[model samples]
Target: MGGKGHIFRKKLFQVGSEYKWLGNSGELKEITLEKRTGVTKELIEKRIKLVTTGIDYHLGHRNCEHFAYFVTGNMPRSDQSIWHMFTDHDPFNIQPMINNFDQLREALLRSKHCGPVGLSRGDFENAVFVSQLDDGYYTYHLSHPLGGQHLYITTVEKAKNFESSYNSIVLAYFGAFFGRGEIFSIVRQLRGC
Candidate 1:
């Protein structure tokens, strides 16, 4: 884990703070309070309170960044190593789950935007996935598959609620930590697709 990244992300979540977003590509962007949306101190606190028992922000953020990188393929380059620290910790048994991504995708299709998440038995308990349809509505799940040793899909609402406690914290942390301009740049690039 990059010591600099860990310290940076930690400071970003220190409450009432600001920082410049530095991309892994070495691009620099400014972040400020006036420009950020969908992220607030209240939301952070609320989400922090919702995490499952025994889970803390440290562990939760690790899980969140790992999943985000897996899905987005972006290594979160904001001078924050929450992403790096997350991977270093290897919070989830993701290595084994890579092959399971197909199973996850298939389960997602069957559930029609509601499931394909939740804890299964063993090291591969927790999971997360996105659900979207023709409607503008979209939701993401963080859960453990139910029953058996193999993966299964649970409802998005449940997964979302589960993630609300900590996953939301990580999202908000990155959003705030990276600031508005940097986020817009990334979002715009993503939308161009």
Candidate 2:
């Protein structure tokens, strides 16, 4: 997959069932209304809240317009929407920084699937997120709410049967996809608390 570029399928994979924050406030709260209603609109609103607040807790929203505000130092027009930016731009080639991260993220949302390009499997209900990165193999986050996220960076040979708690995989082609310091900074900046 090296040189081929990362491919993010537009069809998002429902890795796990967990409650993510609603908005940029980093409040880490989930609205029960959406849960009870199970409406796509309500879910989309919840996603909007998460995007507007600029929280980095969800990997799927990392490359969003709000994420771009801090990364590129360019605030998008209020008239524009997160879906427009996130599902419109290409995120793979674009560096994963505050500046260009949004463009890349937008591209990801536009993709049929968003990821480093790899395969993942697990129990039907409890799925896992896995990615094969250049630097090391990683698990994005496990499905369901479980404490202590796990990342396994091992040899390619071992990667074939790679098993992890997370369902998000960071493919090797991305080149050390997830950086601890960068993510920490983004989370801290977005949280703004």
Candidate 3:
């Protein structure tokens, strides 16, 4: 590994098939739909073997981007490739408070992946009309018709921080890359989030 400035490549590719909320607001659902790569478990597993050989990476060739293409079959690419930003660890690096909740809603919608970046107190009753819970949390009142209504939950503290907060709602949901034993840090899955 490059020891912070150095880039690390996987000895092989690994992904899970579990269906969890892709982002705090299910951002990946939309992106995956737009994706046209068709793959199989067998193919992915086979490619996973290549990493153990330890090969050199070349730009637009045997690089990480190309490796992703081989594993995902999706024409590998990146969104924010500049990896030096430890900005996620500092809340101040993110747009402060966001002023009003209404502005937050607009920001959320305008967010890169239609996912939320952090928690803001808002009465977004559009999802489902549910009775407020005694603990301040509320549930969707399934009485109305189903419209892909879903809810995501996280601790109140993380809702207020960065790093983890990037995927909290959905501001450019890039999966943060991390090293072993690395602590509270930012992560992304390479192709921009």
Model 2 scores what on Cα lDDT?
0.32
lDDT of each: 0.31, 0.32, 0.31
- Candidate 2 TM-score, C-alpha based: 0.22
**Cα lDDT of model 1 overall?**
0.31
Cα misplacement distance, residue 97 of candidate 2 (Å): 6.1
- TM-score against truth, every candidate: 0.19, 0.22, 0.22
* Count of clashes, each model: 12, 40, 14
Candidate topping lDDT: 2
Q: Which stretches of candidate 3 lie over 4 Å from their true place?
A: 1-21, 24-34, 56-60, 72-193
- RMSD to the true structure for each prediction, in A, is 19.7, 19.2, 20.2
User: How many angstroms is residue 133 displaced in model 2 relative to the true structure, after the best TM-score fit?
Assistant: 2.2
